[model samples]
Target: MLYDYPEYYETAFSFRNIEEESRFLTKCINRFSKIDVKNVFEIACGNAPHAGLLQEMGYSYHGLDINRNMLDYAAYLWKDLPNKVNLHEASMVDFKYPIKQDFAYVMLGSLYLNDFDEIVSHFNSMSNLLNSGGLYFLDWCIQFGDPLAHNNNNRFVIEKDGIEVESEFNIKLLDQEQQMYEEVWTIKINDRGRRKQFNMVERNKAILPDQFLRFIKERDDFEFIGWWKDWNLDNPIEDENNVTRPIALIRKR
Candidate 1:
């Protein structure tokens, strides 16, 4: 099963700043109007913390995650706002519901996957999930444009409640044509010399700003708004600060 390790799932909690993320999304949302974005949907909404903010803002928001355990935890944490906030165990690729929404969000590069065709299908699906004048905001990773770089592998180890868990990540380039990378996630738990292993592999396309713009531009269902290259909402596309992770917005046209 995917995301079976409780420890790794817990580790992911620290990798993001939920409050800052919420603020960033809110800034984007404020671009349109103050009218209640009455209905909101978030795909790959791990732990669903962002939905909490949306709920506080008086929006009816739904959260969806591919991991069952993550969704279960979200349900427990957000039990008080059950009506306003609902978390589902589903992937962004195929999740569907009856009601369309005023806004939809997919954060933290979670949309990256093995297939470009599947990714396009998902973008289209998400566009369909929004209302005519609705918005879909996405924050994703972009290729480091530096001329000097190489395949990188990294590891993080932490101790919580006396349990030592180690997580290893390997990012490998898949040649030049596709500009894709295969990510290998491995987590190991060790207690008094006894170790257990859990692993997951996913292939994702590494995006660049130009390519990203072209892809979104070619889609007929949506109109490309712009991108935030380094968190500057105004003129974010050209503001490169050594690295570029873009937050792009689109309106269902």
Candidate 2:
């Protein structure tokens, strides 16, 4: 799988502006967070992309990922930082952490629950780790449009450090009633003339805007803040058709 090769995978998705994203996250904490965020946790964190950056800002960093290679690479990548980062090998749904987190986030819609029951369990676990007034930020995790109509974003190419990586993403409905989807990702990499290909498949449970609101309403530990577009607080999700890069935040009660 592409995730096994940390260098190639980071290069493939390096288009992300980490500095801008880190700044936005800090702004969110300043603008919306009710408590002083001392430490941050990342779910399904790959390569710990924001580890060093967030650490530099004085917040301790912690991340969890199921992939061993990703965790190993993240440890090595941030090993020399002044404040050491905590890396854990576990699934996001029910991972256990003794330390309480002030802010937690997951990027790129990596929430892969199989059903509503799992979703509930995931939230339950999250509630255990986050203290009151903590915030949970989700990016591209809510479905506001037809996944099948996202053909324009299915194919992309990226180049970094003499390595060209091409990625193709396709989604197929697995079950209509359950809102389950099968995502197929094909990655082609050329590392200084060494060509290789990798394929990965994952199943995800899509959480719609209304459904997510209702889900949080049914729970007592969390309160839905709101969902936005393009990472801008001013650009609230007004129209489903124009929902590009949806971002949602929920605060612990």
Q: Which candidate is the best by TM-score?
A: 2
lDDT of 2 by residue, 103-203 (tens): 99999998978888889888998999898999999999999988877756689999999999999989899999988999988999999999999989999
Residue range with the least summed lDDT across 10 consecutive positions in model 2: 236-245
Candidate lDDT (C-alpha), each:
0.70, 0.91
Score every model by TM-score: 0.82, 0.98
Model 2 quality (TM-score): 0.98
- Backbone Cα, N, C clashes tallied per candidate: 0, 0
Superposing all C-alpha atoms, what RMSD in Å does each candidate have to the true structure?
Answer: 3.3, 0.9
